[model samples]
Target: MRLDELPLLTVLIVLPLVGAAVVWALPRAARARARTVAVTVSLLELVVAVAAAGAFDTGDAGTHQLLETHPWIPAIGASYAVGVDGVALLLVLLAVVLTPLVLLAADRHQGGTGDRLQHYLALVLVLEAFMVAVFAARDVFLFYVLFEAMLVPVYFLIGAFGGPLGRWAAVKFLVFSLAGGLIMLVAVIALYLQGPGGPQGFLTDNLTGLDLPVVGERLMFLAFFLAFAIKAPMWPVHTWLPDAAQNATAGTSTLLVGVLDKVGTFGMLTLCLPLFPDASRWAAPVIIALAVVSVLYGALLAIGQQDLMRLIAYTSISHFGFIVLGIFAFTSVGVQGSALYMVNHGLSTGALFLVAGFLVARRGSQRIADFGGLQKVTPVLAGTFLVAGLSALSLPGLSTFVSEFLVLVGTFARSRPAAVVAVVGVVLAALYVLITYQRLFTGPVRDELATTRDLSVREVWVVAPLIALMVVFGFYPAPMIDLVREPSLVTLDQVGVPDVPGGTVVDRAADGGTDDGDDEGSTR
Candidate 1:
């Protein structure tokens, strides 16, 4: 069969589910083979995602591609619909890419329930399928279902397999998520009723640009945005994350914070802006303020955290703040930058969480004060940790720097004061990263951990790809930036926001130059 003819996205979603079922079906005697099976399945899923990317029509990547729709509920205008635009495709790829590495990082000791490795691995695979599905969903109902359903595997991953306080953390995570999901559900039903009633009424394409009532539009927008914000875990609603991170396993935290939380931001761009254009523009100022607060609040809290896991989790809140800020900024560069930031953040933060998990496992503690001077003893572990940390702080040569620079410049072009205020969070970011690094890795060798071992070959394999991608993208972000450009323009067009001459649309009048990079003298 031709690549285009193949149901690649469905397969991408289903393959892991099949893998999960296979994992669960493993006999008691065959439990030991579970890890190998799970890893192999996740790798296959990644291969399929790459194939989909190859077949993707980059020339017109802004529109949904490889779409599949099967009438799921004809009565309410819902369907089993899925597809990916450039940004959605990238996020889907992120989910598949992280699954196997996280699985490989899971050690035998992490098998909390007796012979529960298979169940745990199956849960991971199930979560992977949902992650891909949620990002790829085109039907709002489908998206909402997957959004709430994702909690199942995650709940188990945290509550059953996590650390000492895992149960409490799991309950907290559930409460916050359920509350958000419930609000989004109401918004979804209302949207369906207000939309063209048919088999596919809930499809985003069918609903976009509807002439929603002035008050209703804003209300629904709030309802939908509330769910996303909580999921994004921004500012006031972000309290659940650190606790979950503290109790859950490294792989769980990596996927949960790194990829899952992005659903909220992704929903904003895909649903909020396009579906309620006027309301989005109206609410932009208020949302920007909240996003900036999340940025500073998260970074400040991260600095003060004593637990390494909780600290890393808190940093995600701040990073997400920048993403929401860029999206709400409503400029082409801002939207594009936020999209790229999502992908890059997944890479850097996933690596950081995994490495930190490894360190805690080896040292048998999550407290920052537990050990010091690890660099002299374990150069490799220390080195990888440092690279991940540097990426977190947006060091000039890393992937994050490029995206962050775009966000700030884009925001400045539209909202200079907010941009200026957000920059303080950037300065604070440096302090948390440096202080944590200094306290944990640098001082005189601690007597207790003087003989500590370095990263295992498997651990090195887990981190290498993420670090290499960060370095490569740092130097050449063109490809990544290109992926988001067409979609960014479409988003801005929806919001009726023109790229003010300086950044997004390019200030050819000011510079006396055209967008054609080589034409220094050419102008309109």
Candidate 2:
């Protein structure tokens, strides 16, 4: 079959489902093989994702590629519609790449046979399936279903394999997600009613360009953005993240905070902006303000964190703020940087969690004070942690630095003051990372951890790919840049915002083509 003719996306989605079943069905004698099964399945998923990349055309990255639409629920205008643009494609790839590493790095001997090892691995496989589908879903309702559906595997991952407060964290996460989902459901139904009614009315293409009442438009945008913001876990709605991250296992946190959390900003760029352009523009200033606040707030909190897991979680909040700021900046550079930052943050932060997990596993503690002078005992672990930490701070020449720099440059063009304030976040980032590293790896050697083993070969494998990717992308980011450019332009075009010369944002509706304005939203 031709590349386009092949049901590549369905295969991508179903492969994991099959893998989940296979792993779960393993006999008791063979239950230990669950990790093997999961590893193989995730690697296969990565291969399929790479294949999709090979088949994709970067020059036409703006348009959805590899579409597979089929009627699902005729009554509600829902369909099994899915596709990927450059933005979605990159995120899908990130999900795939990270899954294998997580499975490989998972502590197999923790609970032994009774730990339901099969179940944990199976849930991860299931989460992978949803991760791909949610990013690929072109229909609004399908996207919503996948959006809310993801909470299932993640909920279990935290609850089943987490710490003392695991179940409570899971419940809180569910409550928050369901609350947002319910609100989005109302907006989703209202959205379909406002569209051209038909079997595929809920498709994003069909729903775009709707001329609704001003109040209605903003409300829908608010509902959708609220859902995304909560998922993205921005400022006010971000409380659940630290709790969830703290309770979950390292691998779980890696996927939860690193991969799943990105769905929020992705929704903002793809769904909110394209479908509700005017509302997005109208809400820009307030969103940018919140984004800046999240950046500062998360960083400040990170610097003061005693628990390593919570610190990482807080750092992600700050990173996500940068992402939202970039998306709302309404510049090609900003959006592109935001898009790329999503991938970079996943790599850097995910590795941080994994390495921290390695340390926690050895020392049996997640507290910063629990570790000290480990650089001499476990030089390799110390080194890997440092690399991940430096990446967190967006050290020059790292992959994160490239993305973070782009976001700043792009935002500076539109909102210098906001960008200026965000720079304070950059300074705070350095402090938090350095302080954490100093406490964990420097000073007098801890007598208790004197014999702590360095990273084993398997542990090395888990972080090697992540570290290598960061280094490769750090020096050469052209491929990522190409992937994000077209979609950035597409989002800009859909929002009806003209790129003004000299960093000004020209509102076609507001200025009537004559007046120039900075991102007025940044000020508010």
Best by TM-score: 2
The pairs that clash in candidate 1 are: none
Error of 2 at 139 (Å): 0.3
Going through the candidates in the order shown, the clash numbers are: 0, 1
What are the per-residue Cα lDDT tens digits for candidate 1 across 216-317? 998999999999999998989999999999999999999999899999999999999999887887788888899999999999999999999999999999
Best candidate, lDDT-wise? 2
Off by more than 4 A, model 1: 503-524
Q: TM-score of every model? A: 0.95, 0.96
True lDDT of residue 384, candidate 2? 94
